[model samples]
Target: MTSPASPYVGRFAPSPSGPLHLGSVVAALASWLDARAHGGRWLVRMEDVDGPRTVPGADQVILAQLAALGMTSDDDVIYQSSRHAVYEAALARLTAMGLIYPCGCTRREIADSAPIHAVSGERPYPGTCRTGLQPGRGPRAWRVRMPAGVHCFEDRWLGRQCQDVAREVGDIVLRRADGQWAYQLAVVIDDADQGVTDIVRGADLLSSTARQQVLGQTLGLPLPRVMHVPLIVDTDGRKLSKQNGAPAVDTQAPLVALQAAWTALGFAPLPDASTAAAFLTQATDAWRLRWHIHPCSA
Candidate 1:
């Protein structure tokens, strides 16, 4: 796991809406262990761009939890709230390329207009405001003019995947009605700027990968390698999340917590270790061997 010229960089980007839960830790551990397995840099990014969703002091609390779990950022952690100007500049560039448009259709209107049987029942934003907003309608959001074609990419863990951004996702919103940056745009820009070579996280984001790849091409930024691990779901078969009332990570017994997270990532119980640090060392070795990591290939 010592790649001198790999320049591999991975990140655990958690939205600071709540504390770290079992699901969140699973994603975090996968990213951290991947970075370690490749002898790369692992970063922690606070996705606090959505002001309304962010909880006060949640970032600090989350950092402390990660530290106690034996994973820490390799460099200064970045917060999305501090990068508004940069996001604005990217929007300007898209605007200049005639790829940005103001949308006035509300979420309800889009959903109602969409075919109910669509994939995941998600309304593909019928492009109502593509040409121009309805007469007398004001701009509630800004969306990108998705190019016509299928955007495809290969996943390290899930094999090949594809999506037609224009037909399947329609024009993606760049700025929300609330005037905050959207995840699709912000995350792509951040990864390119940070020179992140690899992305490892939960499989829930697998669908978004193709759209992100399209956006990367539109922005002329290099796309990062991707690996989406299995998602942690509840008894009802729904993904665990803050909105679904997932429980906070049990940190009192750090080693147990670490092992549980690793197991959630589809690994057997790691070799017995007393401390979180020791467990992580053993886990890294296991991860490297399991993935067949090679210094030059990384």
Candidate 2:
């Protein structure tokens, strides 16, 4: 669907750290089903912003995994690695607006004082580098000045959600000391640029929504609708991830893999389909009914 005509534009952005584990597939499948449910477009993005975490050839491998499951990007998939200039321009605008500043505090120094986030379990910065850098200290990174008040939005799955960005997240990093771009900045810019109208992802990212909403406001971009699906956890109750050594989805039997992912999305197992494509079609129809979404003309 074209940007203006599409009723919904969803995406699944996977980091090229390793491969698509079961958790990653759950997010990918949900985004694909939601896009199909609305007769909209589904795009894929490689979030290899952090070069250190990226593995060579991992992007293609992940794409292959999705293809095996009958999922593929609608448009030419974009990689964050190729969009440095755009991110720089966004940073420039925030700087021109006096909303971003150099952060000089090191992790050890900040960890000694800042409080941890309740839900996300991340240590919220205390704005130690907010006012100005210490006398002789130099800028190690850059941070957005979290404005006062709350940013609110309704998630398709989570209902009404709100977060005090200033208090809970504090000033967030836009770029790290190692020159790696921040996920928040890159994602907001990418989604706006790609005209993504809906975002269906894992619950682990739910906490980053308000921070992104505030960033989008600063950038004068439209906020996309979102739905966060439940995460697939391991025996230890931690979310499965590439970094956690979660094995790649076994694509040898595509139907079985697809059924497992479907069930993880809170759906009952579908009757055996002849092919992965057939299974996806059934899943999309069920997804549309579950979400009460009528097929859009686009």
Choose the strongest candidate by lDDT: 2
Candidate 1 regions exceeding 4 Å error are 1-6, 116-121, 295-298
lDDT of each: 0.88, 0.89
How well is each residue in 1-298 modelled by candidate 1, as lDDT tens digits?
A: 1133548899999999999999999999999999998888999999998999999999998999999998999999999999999899999999999999999998888878976435534567788888998999999999999899877777889998878777777889999777799999889999988888899999999888888888888889888889999988999999989989999898888898899889988899976788998999999988998899985644
lDDT of 2 by residue, 197-263 (tens): 9999999999999999899988889888888999999999999987788989999888989998999
C-alpha lDDT of residue 107 in model 1: 81
Residue pairs with colliding backbones in model 2 are: none
What is candidate 2's TM-score against the reference?
Answer: 0.96
The estimated TM-scores of all candidates read: 0.95, 0.96
